[model samples]
Target: MNTETSEIQGSCHCGTVRFQVRLSEGLMTARRCDCSYCRMRGAVVVTASLRDFDLISGEEALSLYQFNTHIAKHYFCSRCGIYTHHQRRSDPHQLGINASCLNGVSPFDFEEIPVNDGVNHPSDRVSRGGSEVVGVLRFVPSNR
Candidate 1:
């Protein structure tokens, strides 16, 4: 995780959705989740204050998806079918921006990303003991 802070531009796959956001802890907050939804979507997300995210364009092209508790609001491009960001269920004030959507950024950029145990989310637990790091996802590039 990196602490360098900077506002960056991002867009959906087909360029139907465009947005800019200031990462709260830069890439320091980057993480993956093992929840059912996250497991299927498979996006490396970084944290950002909802107030710091700006939807520059394609408002109508954005689609929302929520399930189960419906606290976390997942958003994506309706046209390109690419996820842009989501409002975190653990903290509504924060948005989880897909690192792949950011310009000049990719999920492969991180060699080792922490994976949260979303299957046993804190909200569902009696103690509400915060997120748990179940494991790490490492990407090793081939020399060939």
Candidate 2:
């Protein structure tokens, strides 16, 4: 496990879901998804093992929403109604932080990241949606 040396802070629009992550260069690896919600939100995700993320204040300020297999727990600020981060269903040990939520970090650094097919994950024993394996594409180039 990589030790975190710097801290990155983030909050929802309403200032309710305040949290911090111990940042490291390794954590900057971002990935996008073509799943319905992901595409709509234009989220680039950076994963941190649960130990790296801290919910400083606002445990009660947040609400949990789950769908489909109910393996992933999407956490949103109840006050501001912002989806800040989620406990990943694919990897139970990691927390998926929305790249957009990180202050001062550009998605450009994470360009050309591989997009995983959450909509048709093979581990999904029960199909909630149609299977469509989409090829990963560079959503944004570094120069752009």
Candidate 3:
């Protein structure tokens, strides 16, 4: 996370779904989950208000996948088949960006951040640090 305010760009693996996000320092929030799908995908979640994200291209080239609770609508590039961002089921007002999808941002940069387990849907367990663990669908401010 850059301390200075800067714009970060991201895209799917195939370069089809391109988007930009404006981030403040410490925007990469690490969320850990033991849930089957999240664990299997190894997702580190970071989020921004819907107003902060913009789809630059490949609208037609994108595909959406939803299942189970179906609250979160996962977006991926149809061409390369990469998960880009998702409309959060818990908070439809925000978009959860896969931190791995953003360019120039490394997961190592925010490794010190705490991880919240979404496994078994532990929606009520707060971490030792006192941050609220509302649900598996948590959002961190991009301009934190």
Number of the top-ranking candidate, with lDDT as the measure: 1
Report lDDT per candidate: 0.92, 0.70, 0.69
Rank candidates, TM-score, best first.
Answer: 1, 2, 3
lDDT of 3 at 21: 80
- Which candidate, 2 or 3, would have the higher lDDT against the true structure? 2
Tell me which of candidates 1 and 2 scores higher on lDDT. Answer: 1
lDDT of 1 by residue, 19-137 (tens): 99999888888899999999999999999999999999999999999999989999999998999999999889989999999988889889989999999998888686899999999
Q: Between prediction 1 and prediction 2, which has the larger TM-score?
A: 1
In model 2, which range of ten residues has the least summed lDDT? Answer: 125-134
- At residue 63, candidate 3 shows an lDDT of 93
Task: Please provide TM-scores, in order, for all candidate models, with all chains considered together.
Answer: 0.96, 0.74, 0.73
Please say which candidate is ahead in lDDT: 1 or 3.
Answer: 1
Query: What ranges in model 1 sit over 4 Å off?
Result: 1-5
For residues 21-42, what per-residue lDDT tens digits would candidate 3 score against the true structure? Answer: 8643336454655556766776
Q: Scored by Cα lDDT, where does model 3 land?
A: 0.69
